[model samples]
Target: MLRPFLMFASLAFFAFSAPVQTPPPSGAPAAAPAPAVPADAAQTPNPVKPTAESQARAKQIYGYDCALCHGEKGDGKGDVAADMKTPMGDFTSSATLKSMTDGELYYVILKGKGQMPPEEGRAKPAEIWNLVIYLRSMSKQ
Candidate 1:
């Protein structure tokens, strides 16, 4: 009877005690409320419209090497355009770049056009593909 009474008293005491509130796990930080901002700032920037990785690669190569002969924006009005004996075609014209295929452009890049030196030793096949993508992008079609 004494043992049973002692057990009942211990159970009662434990039941009356406050519940143990476990703290958050270690290394975890409490989240803070988000700050309010202007509605305009909430608008995300325009997504990249390149649409394809190849197009992006082409733009990169054009900016690096061809931009001198072809404008940085491919307007065909690059800095070297004036000095070059054979005028570089205006890429922004749309009609010109549209007609040519990736193969044709690659050939020109490899063989060089008029005064434009062949990049045979300088650029690899993959790099030339990028240039083709950039040229195709210039076309309106």
Candidate 2:
């Protein structure tokens, strides 16, 4: 009985003791920065940050294009929100916005998440930037 138990323990130990495989050693410097992704491939796309004039232009465009779903106050409770299956995001939450990069925001706006549809045709580039700025501004409050 002891002999059988010892054999089983040895087999178990061997089974658990397989050498861990290490990843390939980093012999060379890291690769260069990747190129930006194009608008066509990604569901949500981030555009480069806009200039002041463009930002202001973005605001107007946002009011015209985005206010329906995002709300006039950026609170995610726009009038049309009732029509959506997914509720709009609550922009006032710093915790939620801080983790997301500008690019991530762009992607969400360009590519609708869950119930939201992509804004690609609904908004021009400038309009999207305004929404980004609005989201960024939400961080302060």
Candidate 3:
């Protein structure tokens, strides 16, 4: 009798202890939220000067983290990008980044856009700035 009671108690405790998540009423997800870009994002300037060493570090980071979706050449043709419905922007094209400022890029990198998760904690602020510079160079090349 005691063993049976303990089993029932354990079962009740587990059933209540687990988290409960209800499905949405619509049974579908809402649209993706707009990235949190500041009004001054366009005015933000790149504080990190592009040096060979900084660019190299950015390259290493990009290769490991971003190359899966952003391509090795910044051409938006990474392996994962082929599976995505929305195409990644081509950094090799000057027109692709002509309107965006350094700050805007920084915000996108730090906060994330669409399916791209925020790169926060993966790199320092200065390294992100270096990534922006590295991306800009892709168009020039």
Cα lDDT computed for each candidate against the true fold: 0.65, 0.68, 0.86
* Reference-based TM-score, model 1: 0.55
Per-residue lDDT over 33-130 for candidate 2, one digit per residue giving the tens place of the 0 to 100 score: 43344554444445556677877777676677777887886778898785643376677777767766666677677766554557789887656756
Per-prediction TM-score: 0.55, 0.53, 0.75
**Model 3 C-alpha lDDT per residue in residues 28-135, reported as the tens digit of each score:** 544357587887976888988888899999989889888889899999999987765448889999999998889999999988877687889978999999999988
Each candidate's root-mean-square deviation in Å? 23.1, 13.9, 5.4
C-alpha RMSD (angstroms) for model 3: 5.4
Q: For model 3, name the residue pairs that clash.
A: none
Put down candidate 1 lDDT per residue, 3-108, tens digits, no spaces.
9999999999998895986664643343233333334433423233445776777677678778887778777788877564336677777777665555566667
Predicted structure with the largest TM-score when compared to the true one = 3
**Clash statistics: count for each candidate:** 1, 3, 0
Whose TM-score is higher: candidate 2's or candidate 3's? 3
Stretches off by above 4 angstroms in model 1 are 1-54
Candidate 2: global Cα-lDDT?
A: 0.68
In candidate 3, what residue range of length 10 has the lowest lDDT sum?
23-32
